[model samples]
Target: MRDPDLDELRAELEEFAQPEKKASRSPREERIIAGFEEIQRFVDEHGRAPRHGEDRDIFERLYAVRLDRIRKLEDCRTLLAPLDRQGLLSGAGTTADAGSDDMDEDELAAELGTINGFEITELRHVRPSAEKRAAEEIASRQRCEDFSKFKPLFQKVQEELDAGVRETRPFELKAEIRPGAWFIVGGQKAYVADMGEVFTNDQGRSDARLRVIFDNGTESNMLMRSLQRALNKDEAGRRITEPVAGPLFSDQHGDEDQASGTIYVLRSKSDLPLVAENRDLVHKIGVTNMSVEQRIAGARLQPTFLMADVEVVATYKLFNINRSRLEKLIHRIFDPARLDIEIRDRFGNPVVPREWFLVPLSAIDEAIRKIRDGTIAGYVYDPQSAQLVRRGTE
Candidate 1:
């Protein structure tokens, strides 16, 4: 029951079919024929015919196998059949449809419906999870990208230093003697000759010792001034100057502002030997009743704050203990916001938050002994109850 016109079209197509040849055609001819054949096949498969109107040039290239050879009329008919079925060609395959190749933007817009301007803008600004993931991946990738660019410059400087090239000089010294001491005996020593020789050998030695003592005192004074300036620049010194003044206990009657505080400055125990001359001065600051300002004025000294008794209550371990837990064990037990938790070592060193606590010397010794014996894991205190609780015991 197939259409007679379609049957005729198939017969025409068979007639145009070229016999398979043992040898291949020239590359140029093959390329041209392949291009036109693809178009013809597309037309036939879709039940549409090929158009020869604007595509005349393309057809000519495909038919340019040999100018001398007779053109196959049946091949032309077969090529035109599909165009005729699709109404794309006027006569089988002579002309294309009215609007086949023309695409109107307005028409397409009408078919797809109007796009909202706001929606477009929103899409551009919005970032999906995938986009964030991609950005993180890109950043991580860039961090490890290349170090070869900087390696050469680094290696050159290292090599020069290794070769004994002088890169820097950190210190310099200048010296001078007192004018009167310049001429102790003769012509060049005439500066000191004006003075009578008042010393025997022993006296001269004593005079030298006196000069040494004066020089040592002067040097010590200068060094202390420098150290004070350095301490003023330290972080702890700054914090002490800006102490977070707050009320002590609920019933305490003393003016919070009247609370006396001191910065206990001490060189490390290991630095004791190096600072033997200042040992007496340091101890004096700790035991004396002089205010920090008065002490500094009297000795021209700068002191570091004593951080020994500060207790740190970390938020993470706030719940691990019982009665002495930071804040409280349960509701109505402690108000975290009201209670101040600071950590310090036994000898009173101000440790960073989450770091080891500095408690009184007495507490530290007991804590260490208990820890060594595996009796406790940590130390906690309840200010309200005035009690200390070990980690493992109730």
Candidate 2:
């Protein structure tokens, strides 16, 4: 009963309504795009491209290497050029930071892996020979001869966990490997006691030896990759959070009981000749649970601000940390650079401000980096070198 003309019209309209086919990319191109996007995310969050340095976190160093390689390759530049809204690719060479080469381009690509939401292009049915050897090293654990020294640490971690001062969360990245970091693997609490110098493996990948102490008093000198693999394979693998004071910083926040605060670095805007002369070098480091704006209000009326207006140089938001202790710890690290200026309050009482230090902003950035990775305990800021040096080395 239908008209032939009506049927023909409906068929034509259906053809017009079909969706356009997306441009398909080759696996190699997809991998390149995925890797570049990771760098882009890093830039977005950190406000700068990752730089290379021993003081820099391992992941930042990896990103620095990755960015350098991407710049060198014409194909990567071409593929990522359209997506470089931040102009991250326009810079020449990698950041000039102090560190040796860890991984070449191909290995770095593999390390970045296929980013989430992308179809994974690479997979292996069998573990690599190097990874297999690392697994063996982990399996051949020895009784820690100096277990007594580490016993108190394990107990303290447990106490903190019970007291809700520290909590454990899922472990996701190999970059988390560092001294003083704790993890739960294979039904045991594992701690990274120390890490050795970064070295290139025979496979041309960046790696380091880790001294991992188990709560059971067994210890293993395993390659960093081994611990990563173990954690990835275990269903219950978790990274134990750090104590609130000697805090290990985590990005995750919980609703019930996570303490959050900000670490603010301030530069005095006083017109005083000495402060004006060294304005760029002097900074006040403080941590507060309230907003920085609220805390800095009435700066000109407060001796703590040198009785002058101030400029916020930087602020780092932290979670589940003791702001007071963190403030004190940072103060202690830069104590040698403490500014010796005396400012009078509205009551005409002279008071020497304790928080201000005559240190460059870059040095403060490096100190925060060490603190986030839980390595600040072993480092002290040397004003002569304007660098964070090992305790015994300086």
Candidate 3:
């Protein structure tokens, strides 16, 4: 016979061993759940699921992709039965990207998220662009075991850039894009250090292999022609020169090869109710080949202007710079603060004006400064924190 205390302890242990009523969700299931929640939030705010188009928010496009992937998974749909308040799993909801029950090409295009003219769908029957192919090839490159040999070159470049001894210039694609040259590819400073055996192509063209290293400690062995093709397609790509024989940051307007454009940050001068309400935080960013005044002179009548007078808040001059690429980068950094409201044109047709975000003026100024110093690449604007934060660790 056991003592009463021992018997009581054994009973308590047995009771504690019983499984709970709910099972913990797996990582995959959790992700599916979160994705559905995000879609529901979009539907709630916009009164519909996120739509597909080049002009639409990239977040919405990504959500459309996620919804398509989830809707096809029967297991996911079943798992989300209780958590899904929006009937996302019932098959009753139509794909946001997919057009109405009528058109054929659009029905397919909706799933593909075809932006502007670019084919964004994962499953494509058409041939891929040369840029896309080259980008994929470069992306597939693994870590370089010999990164140390090239590390010093990047260090020296950074030091010279800091000391104002060397300056970067816009890249122009040429056949002489050979080894021992430095270029900015894929938005990262890259150096071509070595060349492999030359080979002939079916078109009677000569090309050679190259060992290129990026400032981010990554390297690749992409072909020479492939690098040129990639650069030509890249609007922001540039080639750097070895401490050119000139004064640093000098006015090179007469050089004939310098970039000719300006990046202008503007704010509306309209007394419109909405504009008045968010005037301080609401800002528009754009690039113009002409003076900002010339660009916005007729803004009051244009749909792109949201029918408002505007004032230039800031301006950054450029030389051989890709203005569109720079504008895209600034917009991307402040994307989290993007305003979701739509506007109407003078003709009463609905207009969705982009490039406007709810960021503070000081933050915008700081961002532009960071861009000039070339330190903006690794940083992103945090709307919640209302400041810049380093990528990844955030």
Best by lDDT: 2
On residues 1-394, what C-alpha lDDT tens digit does candidate 1 reach at each position? 8899999999999999998877765544443344345444555665544432211232222222211111233543344444334333233443334533121322211222312210111223223432332222111111212334434423433332232111222112111122122111110111111222223332232111111001111111111112223233333321110001222111233343343222222221213232333322222112123443453342211122222221121111111111122111111111211212343544565443221122233333343233223232234444333334653453
Record all residue pairs in model 3 with backbone atoms less than 3 Å apart, i.e. clashing.
259-319, 259-320
Candidate 2 regions with alpha-carbon error over 4 angstroms: 1-259
Stretch of 10 with least lDDT, candidate 1: 183-192
* Residue-by-residue lDDT tens digits, candidate 2, 1-394: 9999999999999988969899999877887787778777888788788886423454565677777777888988898899988787888423555655444534433443423322124533333653454233324577899999999788767745653345788998888889989999878999999999999887788899899999989888888987887788879999987655343344455565455788899999898888999989989999888999999999999999999999998988777665666677788789999999997899999999999999999999888877665556667888899888988888
For lDDT, candidate 1 versus 2, the one ahead is 2
TM-score of each: 0.13, 0.42, 0.42
* Residue 52 shift from truth in candidate 1, angstroms: 70
Count clashes in each candidate, considering only residues at least 3 apart in sequence or on different chains. 25, 1, 2
Candidate 3 regions off by >4 Å? 1-143, 146-259
- Model 3 Cα displacement at 266 (Å)? 1.4
Q: Candidate 1: where are CA atoms >4 Å away? A: 1-303, 306-361, 391-394
